[model samples]
Target: MSAQFSLDNAQKDGNEPIWTVTQLNSRVGRLLEASFSRIWLRGEVSNFTQAASGHWYFSIKDERAAVRAVMFRGRAQAVGFVPRSGERFEFRVTVSLYEPRGDYQVQVDSMRRAGLGDLHEAFLRLKQKLEAEGLFDPERKRTPVQMPQRIGVVTSLAAAALRDVLTALQRRAPHVPVVVYPAPVQGADAPAALVEALQTAGQRAEVDTLLLVRGGGSLEDLWAFNDEALARAIAASPIPVICGVGHETDFTIADFVADLRAPTPTAAAELACRPRADCLQAVDAAFNALTLRQMRLLERASLRLDRARAGLVSPRQRLAQQAERLAALRQRLDQAAARSLERGVGRHATLAARLERCRPQVAQHQRRLTELGLSLQRTLEITLQQRRQKLAALTQMLEALGPNSVLERGYSLTRNAEGKIIKNGLDLKVGETLQIEFGRGSAQTQVLATHGLL
Candidate 1:
């Protein structure tokens, strides 16, 4: 009976296939991964460990439950911050089972501090949308007034930001007027309240510059400034806006849309109004510069006047000077005439001595004159003969080139009625009168017909 029972049990067990530990765990992991895609989980970090391989092993727990999580080296390196125990974080993970131990765990893909992931995502989305629309263009931003006559601040009157701005303004410029446009700086209704306050200030147009400021706070605390409507209101304001919405590291849509962004509320106030002492100093400098310039101009004019005065002369003194100049000119002219007379006398004596030294013998000069006269007559006779020969050749050549020479060659010259010599038959008209000249004489004739050479 025992053998029969054993056989029966073995046969029953043989109907089902057996799975090993590794195979079971692997199948379970695959099922878990397929069942749940990547998901976000928020919990406090515990037992956070960074392994020698740079992988992260940690447990994420809430008050009631906990789950094991592992981030590989590649994923952990991109998380930017090291996970510390007890710090809450939102993790994007994929559910899986550790096949080696068959332990349930999640593979972390990415993580961020709690409450920041969604808000940051929304922030980036809106920023991208507005940027695409050109709302954050640098070209559209106005230049903030260097010195506003009446400054307007928009913030909750009870808030510390308002107090900070007021203190800074009073310290920097007590004489300048300050107007407060109160609005809530935080909470659900804060965005609308801020927009309304901005519109009110803009409609009034009383202030040359407007300050939209708030104190430093966390991103969640300062989320009101990131509203789309508030950003648009700031951009549309008639007066230039100086936005100091958060600490230097904090930024919002309002900061990008405003005319100027200040790191703090006090900085916004300081930017809006120059210090009273600085203004006075500037004015004093300009006045001193003007005074110096005027003094220089006056000195230049006075110098010119002194020069003119020095150049002026009394009429009696002028006449004495003119008389002296005329007397000097008369003495110079007499000296020049005396020099000229002496030079002329010297020249005449030199010529007379040269004439005496070069005295000619009359007989010899007469003989030479006669010989020259004879030579001149002979040269004249030869020149006349050569001139006659050249004239004859030229006359003969002229005669050969003359119109009579062509007429003697059996060609007659014809002149039209207008006295123009007709060189072409085309110039002749049948009814036109023509003068035909032979070598001897010219006769008047009328053309009966014309034949074209062509």
Candidate 2:
């Protein structure tokens, strides 16, 4: 009998213990969990699938074997990038067993691209070292030459990059001279050869700008440009260096340390030498502008000259015109004097008539003023007397309503300690504090006993 069948048989016989399929699977899962908590697995991924419930299923494989794996939605969402088939990665996972099928698998937690770890670490280390030494400071970078008189190239003569650069330079600035300092741009000896070429070019001082260029390639193929020695050499060169080592996305240590970085060798040449056609166009435009300005200036000068010529006159003519103006001014002054004399006489006669008319009115106004003054004095005296009488009546009314008047009439006022007037004796308790007011004085007292209630 099979083990499962025999276990059932034993359970029926009641001679030995038996385990169900569920129990067996549960025990195996517990054992797996107990034995292996978490592990790091390095492998290539394949057969990846994302379920509707957002769970990820895949297999990780190496040369010899493969194992199924899954990443639940929660953990998978934590990954920064999506995973694809056939990509190698290092995964942090937990060993697990699916109970229903009794299948072994790993639950992945996180992942990172494989093979890049060591290279990335090394790249970072060198970058940090150079940056700490101030090799990448903006202040240390040399200013790029605007239009170089001569450009020296440091690259392999066999490289396509060389042809691209030469073609660009020929097309852009044929007037500028180019010197090729041939050097290997790949393999083991490239860094050393490049350094030697740069040093030689520096010593010669035949070029104002230097271009270090190479075609695009894989990171490993372009590793020579990442060399620390190469970077330092580029930084130390007296001639401004423009590095175009790879495509736009590829960055190397030389790119950081060089005076300027271009996307490709052709671009570097274009930068170092401006286009001849563009220069000619600019010169033409400037000449046309200057010519127009000169023409406008000449026209303005001519207009001014014409105006000046038109205004020219003899000294005698100017003197005759001034004499005419002086005669007119003298006539106007004489006319004004005569009119002033006539107006003064007329004003004196009018004033005499007005004085005669106003004399009688003035006397009549004086009599009316005297009458008003007497009336005002009588009214003020009567008002003063009436005010005195009203004040006396008001004083008498106030005295009748005042508490002092009541006190003077043989009545005493009682107030509590809080200054509240007491209206009835029954409102007070024995030993309560009170104040008694009389006409002339006041006294503090205590309620010794109760009185009759109203």
Candidate 3:
């Protein structure tokens, strides 16, 4: 018999072990716990909850099955991470039986979102924590490189990001030197690799600015840059970093944490490196401006020198010359006064003779006006008499045509009930009402007959 336990009552007394389910589980759990103390699991997260005790209760599941998991507040707080529902997640967990319930389960240690769960979650957490610490505030963000001395790139040795950056540098900034710190730009090892490379670049005193760059990739591929550790590294770096990761739309933790975010790797390269062509053009313009300014300044200096020379005569000598000029002006003034007096006397005599010749014409105009006034008086009297006769004729014509004039002739005006005037008997209906206006009174009557004949 191969190591069989004896069933005979006395033979199995001391070493005989009968296990309760709990006991069996505890033993098996201990073994599993030991074997899987640290393990990694990947699956979509579900049934997630945080307890009052600050612990997480959840399940990690695939289409076929699921495993119950819990992260105690101690471990959870240590990492300070949680996953949202329906998101793919991965983490290091321990396989064990909960000693109290004797239930088998996994105890989660560290966690992250679907493929990008870890990096993205870390990025968010750091962003929030640092923001609370005020690291990412506008005040904290470093201004971009308008001019950079030496450009240092942190990217993989074999990467399209490097090639593109080099190509752009060659085209835009041929003269500037580039130093690259090779890194593992993809896969599980990338996050740690990136952090180390950043540290290496940070220690160097020569690197003026840092460019943390990488080629485009899916969320999983770019997850390395989203690490909180890397973000903190970027924030703490004395050298400002310009991040160019993936396409314009792709954003990572490093993007927010870095000093600047360039949409493309080539763009970041151009930003860090200096352009020889632009430098040359700037130099030429500055030289031309300086040459022109120097020429103008020299011309101004020569003009000032000439004016200085002209004003250089002794002050006492200049005063004596001014006195002589004033004496000559006084002599010229007295001569001008004598000539003005002679001209004034001749003008007065000529004006007197012209006045005597004009007096006779004035008397002739007065006589002609008196004769025209007398003829106007006769015309006014005849016009008034004619107007009076016309007024008397118009008054007689008005008395003949007026309605009141006809009433005075003993004719009455008759009207129908509707206030319409009755001009003919044909217009009246028998038994219809009528109103009549007489010379002294008015009367109302009914129509006795309808007759057209007068």
Worst 10 residues of 3 by lDDT: 1-10
Per-residue lDDT tens digits for candidate 2, residues 1-454, read 1233334434555466777888778777777776777888998877889999989999998768999999999999989777766567999988888999989999998988886433445677998999999999989988777778889999999999999999999888998999999999988899999999999999999999999999997665688898989999999998999999889998889998899999999899988976899888889999999999999999999999999999999999999999999999999999999999999999999999999887767788999999999999999999999999999999999999898888899899899999999998889999999999999899999989997855
Q: Is candidate 1 or candidate 3 better by lDDT?
A: 1
TM-score for each model: 0.46, 0.45, 0.44
Identify the runs in model 2 with alpha carbons over 4 angstroms from their true place: 1-121, 127-146, 156-164, 179-208, 215-222, 233-240, 246-251, 313-410, 415-420, 424-454
How big is the positional error of residue 163 in model 2, measured in Å on the Cα after superposition? 5.0
lDDT (C-alpha, whole model) for all candidates: 0.88, 0.88, 0.81
Model 2: residue 308 alpha-carbon error in angstroms: 2.6
How far residue 59's Cα lies from its native spot in candidate 1, in Å, is 20
Cα deviation of 418, candidate 2, in Å: 6.0
1-454, model 3: which lDDT tens digit per residue? Answer: 1233323333355665665666567667878888888889998777789999999999888768888999989888876555665568777899988766777799998876546443446657766886787656767878656556677889998998999988888788776677888889887788888888889988885678888999897666787887778888888888888999999999887888788889989888877755778888998999999999999999999999999998899988999999999999988988888888888888888888887876577677788777778778778878888899899899999988888788878998999878999988888888999999977788999988886674
TM-score of 1: 0.46
Question: Taking the tens digit of each residue's C-alpha lDDT, what string does model 1 give over 73-143?
Answer: 99998888786665679889999998888899999999988844345667888899988988899999888
Model 1: per-residue Cα lDDT at residue 222: 87
Clashing pairs in 1: none
Tell how far residue 433 is off in model 2, in angstroms: 8.5
